[model samples]
Target: MKGISYARYGGPEVLEYGELPDPKVGPDAVLVKVRAAAVNPVDWKCREGHLDGILDAVFPVVPGWDVSGVVVQPGVSVTEFTAGDEVIGYVREDFLSRGTFAEYVAAPVRTLARKPRNLSFEEAAGLPLVGLTAYQVLVKALQVKRGETVLVHAAAGGVGSVAVQLARHFGARVIGTASEGNHDFVRGLGCEPVEYGDGLAERVRGLAPEGVDAVFDTVGGEALKISADLLAPEGRLASIADGDVVGYGGRYYWVRPDAEDLLRLTELAEEGVVSVHLSQTFPLERAADAHRLNQEGRTRGKIVVTVEWEVEPAG
Candidate 1:
């Protein structure tokens, strides 16, 4: 099999595409033939060793988490899915080694879910990590309620875009922070768009003078601090970007893969309540380029890397 990997931590330059050994499936995992993999900021972060404090990297690590693919074989003990099932997964474990940026991956059942029937493989591939991040944060961390005012930072981003949409679905009046260029895009997601940077607080106050009922921060540091200040009395705040949020009386969330949660996201997707905007896509061999594009930090939606295989003609 072939995949993208980096033998040591560095920039995108460290990533190399080449032949790799086939993966062995575990008792609770299934071997999937990769269709598409989503490019995320974390992919590069892991490549550069930024997550070293937590996740240990096995040398020559394959770097991807979100994936949509078909099951080619199920483990001996697995019954939840069989060969030919289409699935999506956030395939991260405690360590960096096996990943979705390959021709195949052995995904644990806990991290797998049936792909949304309404989405293409490219779009479904972008959902797991970003979708779960927004879903878990809004539904569990902040508990966004209808009729409440919610503020989301980086609203046009992968996580923020889904966050704003989910908040609105829960009946919250959402205000999303994005660049001036993305205001219209943010507005289309059922959010009141506010330009970030320079008087961001004032702009938010202009929309909700008293303060918002919930703040979802996707950018860390100053953005997280501003979100902490924009909350209404007894308002909730959560940040996926900053661990320091704990110091400001907010929860710092790390997205976990749950089969149940991913299923709900698929339902929302099939029901037309949630969707991925595919900003760009690259072939698996060009995954390094995908990382470069995401590192630019201006992407409006998800970037995907696709694996294409030739099919033999029918007998």
Candidate 2:
């Protein structure tokens, strides 16, 4: 099957597109025919060996974690889904290889969820990793509650956009930081938009006056440190990108695949409580371009790679 891969850890220039061996399905996995895949910053980070200490790399690695596709074959032990089911997944494995960038992937049932009926394959493909990242940080790590005031860094970004919506859904008054160009876009997600960089703290203070109850940092580094300083006396903080949060009495979180969390996001999508804003779509062969675009750090929402395939009706 045709797919994109890199034999060694490096930049987007190292990616190669061609035929590769099909992934084998394990007894606990289902083989999916890829319809669409979404690019996350982690895809490039992994490609460049940034996660070398945390995730084992198998050379000629297929790089991607988000996918929306049709189930073509279910393993003997799989019962949650059958052939012909349309699903979305954050298909990360214990090791790096056999990823969603390919024409097919053997996804464990734990990572699979029924696609939201309201979303197309492209939109559904964009949800898993980003949606789950925001959901986990807001719902699990920070435990944001009703009527509280929350601040989200990089609010117009893939994760931050979803974070803004989720915080609003939880009844929190949300303040999101983005560039002036995306202020309206952030407001559309139900957040009070503030421009990021220098004096970010002062701007947030002007919006909240009393300090925010919780802070969710997606940009890390300076943003994370600034978020820590904007917190109220008992404020909580969590960051997906910065480990520095731990030193500042905040928690650092890494997104994990939870079928239940994915289901919650699916419900939000179906109910029109959350929406994906796609910045670009590329063919599978042009994955390098997708990576380049994401690395620029200017895209809002998601970048999807669509796969062309004939869908046969299940008899």
Candidate 3:
């Protein structure tokens, strides 16, 4: 099957497109034919060895985690889905080898969910990781309540955008940090948008005077450093970007794949409670370019890489 892989950890130059062997399915897994895959910053981070201490990489690694595809076959022990079932998955494991960037992936049942019928494969491809991150952090880590004020950093971004919408769905008033240009875009997602950088805390304070009830930090470093100041007493804080958040009385979160949580996202999507915005799309072979654009750090939403299948001639 044709796909992308890298034999060594380096820059995007290391990614190559070619034929790789098909994956072997386990009893608790299903084989999904590639339709589309979403590119997350973590994809490039893993490619460059930034995640090496946590996830061991098998060289010539196929690198992608989020996929929207169809089941060609189910594993011997599986009954949750069968051939022709449309599904999406955060197809990650403890290490990197087989991944969703390929023509097919063997996804464990624990990572699979039925795709939202209201979403296209490209949009559905962008959901699993970002949706899971937002849902997990908002519902579990921060416990944001209705009528509370919440602030989200990088509000127009993949995880941030979803977080803003999900928080609004829970009846919280949201404030999101973006740029002057994205303020309109962020507002469209149902939040008051504040430009990030110098005076970020002041801008957030302007919106909520007493301080927000929760701060969702997607931009770390200096942003995480000041997040504590933006919070009201007993206000919650969580950061997916910085581990130092733990030092500031916040939870440093890493998103985990859960079928139940993903299903909730699917339901929200179907009900029009949340949406995945596709900022760009690239053919599978040009995945390296996708990484380059995402690394530029100005994307408003998710970037996706698509696998186009040839149409069979009718006889």
Best by lDDT: 1
Kindly report the root-mean-square deviation of model 3 from the true structure over all alpha carbons: 0.9
lDDT measured at residue 108 in model 2 versus the true structure, 0 to 100: 97
> How well is each residue in 92-199 modelled by candidate 2, as lDDT tens digits?
987888889989999999999999999999999999999999999998899999999999988999999999999999999999989999999998889999987788
**Model 3, residue 76: C-alpha shift (Å):** 0.5
Worst 10 residues of 1 by lDDT: 191-200
Evaluation by lDDT, superior candidate among 1 and 2: 1
Comparing 1 and 2 on TM-score, the stronger one? 1
Worst 10 residues of 3 by lDDT: 195-204
Off by over 4 Å in 2: 311-315
lDDT of 3 by residue, 181-296 (tens): 99889889999988877888888888899988999999899999888988899999999999999999999999999999999999999999999999999999999999999999
The clash number for model 1 is 1
The segments of candidate 3 whose C-alpha lies over 4 angstroms from its true place after superposition are 313-315
What's the true lDDT of residue 268 in model 2? 95
TM-score: the better of candidates 2 and 3:
3
RMSD of 1: 0.7
